[model samples]
Target: MMQRTISTTKHWIVIVLMSVLGCGLLIQGGYMQAKAHFAQFLIERAFEQTLVDNQPHKPWSWADTHPVAKMRVLQQQTDGFQPLGSDLYVLAGASGRNLAFGPGLMLGGAGLGEQGNTIIAGHRDSHFMRLQYVKLGDIIELYSTEGERVLYQITATEVVHETDMKVLAPTAEKHLTLITCYPFDQLSGNAEYRYIVEAKPIDAQPLYS
Candidate 1:
């Protein structure tokens, strides 16, 4: 009958709509899960790479997974804190992730505590994502491969635009800057602002190479 045909058509349309919505949700969940996993992987790697070996070497590559550097005498919450060497800190996003969002290479500056400001950058999802949890006076540590250890303390935190160059400038006294995505809880994946952690160098060792 004509009535039966119309009912069947409506049922099919409803089924198709449900299917489409389900598919969309699945895709979105997958993307968010992937971002979270990548973030976790980054922190763990930093811990193993910098904590276990504090001093990082020149021309250090993310591909080079071995102990290219080492750190000594960590400060702050040493257990959870993964101190980046001055080598990788200056290089600036060497791991295909713009911890700094610029074209410059990662960790290009010298690795030490005597510099003006050892600026370090990492990706929000792939590196330094835990920076969101950091508080004032949090300790930062670094160790070198040639038997050197350095320590820093978080003095303050700030949020700035991506193009703000003052965040990376050198200061009159030795300092360390940790930068990552601002509003770390954003779900839209748009990095609008940057979180800056200002710290001062407490320990320094002369270059032994």
Candidate 2:
């Protein structure tokens, strides 16, 4: 009789442990999904505000980052490569915390529409996933907070070690640089490589409204 009671207690303890683990996983998954959705909403609001006011706008009261520009890739074929889509919100500052919310502009780099290089970075799983499809000669439209829209033609794409700092170097002419982690479909662990896209301004006039 004592053996039976001990066995039953052990079984119940195992069941309780499993239940707790399941609940923890469920909560984590739910929170991640919710965060992704909320980040998109925040980006959209910030983009709209920048367009309407022609000034930097924060998505939320507590946000340390603000919308600095809006970017879209042209759908036309460029060197036999066509991008999937052309809509992205550019946020100020590219810290890990800022990137969790959306694509961020590197703070020390030149501002959008400036004469030097402007570097932007986004998460591989979310904001920059579409970058994998971008190809040479594809046009990228960047709208700045000053109500100026500049067009950039993609000139190059490369994979480099994460420690390569040359990718972020300032240019003598206007340029746009995008950075994201490599191996977009990785299931686990941080990637050691980075995927980079480089573009040069093509038009002097603001083409996008």
Candidate 3:
């Protein structure tokens, strides 16, 4: 009888510990979701101001990154073209910290809507999640702070090792390369592979033209 009582007590203790752990996980998840939404709101406001003045605007006073461009994807619909999702504000500098808020323009890449390959990187589960559903021939539209809009058609999508730097190489012709970790459904962080989406301008003319 005593052994059974002791076992019962231990089981209750285990259950209580698990309950606490589950609640903690839920709280952390809620906090992260709230932060993500709030950050996007601030980023959107800063992007709008940048568009109005044609200057970079920091999403927050202490943020190290600023809005550089606004990007959105479009897919063909029965009626006409429709946005795949809401616009994502592209930040400057593809540092990991900067990418937490939105996609970041990688260094050594061409300027937005410029003649060389422009590279952007984002977290797979966050801002770039829509990329997984994108297919060849979809349209990627980028709006620069200078009031210029460029349309790029998705030409290729491939998965490559994370160490492969070829994707970041400058292209002779204008193109856009988007990078995100592969296997979006993975529960682990820091995947070894990367998913790349290559796009080219629909028109060869200068952006301002």
Candidate 2 structure quality by residue, lDDT tens digits, 1-209: 99999999999999999999999977885686568558767877877877787776778888888878777876454244344554677888999988887789998899988889999998887778888887787777877776677888889999999889999898998999999999887724579999999999885433332
Candidate 2 global lDDT: 0.81
TM-score of 1: 0.55
lDDT of 2 at 202: 83
**Which stretch of 10 consecutive residues in model 1 shows the poorest summed lDDT?**
66-75
Q: Please, what are the lDDT tens digits per residue for candidate 3 over residues 125-190? A: 778888999989888999988879899999999999988999999888999999999898873676
Runs in model 1 with CA error above 4 Å? 1-110, 187-189, 203-209
How many times do residue backbones clash in model 3?
0
Order of the predicted models by TM-score, top scorer first: 3, 2, 1
User: Model 2, 52: alpha-carbon shift in Å?
Assistant: 3.4
Error of 1 at 176 (Å): 0.2
- Local error of candidate 2 at 21, Å? 8.7
| Model 2 lDDT at residue 102 | 76
TM-score (C-alpha, index-matched) for candidate 3: 0.87
lDDT of 1 at 52: 48
Steric clashes per prediction: 20, 2, 0
| Full ranking by lDDT | 3, 2, 1
Model 1 root-mean-square deviation: 8.1
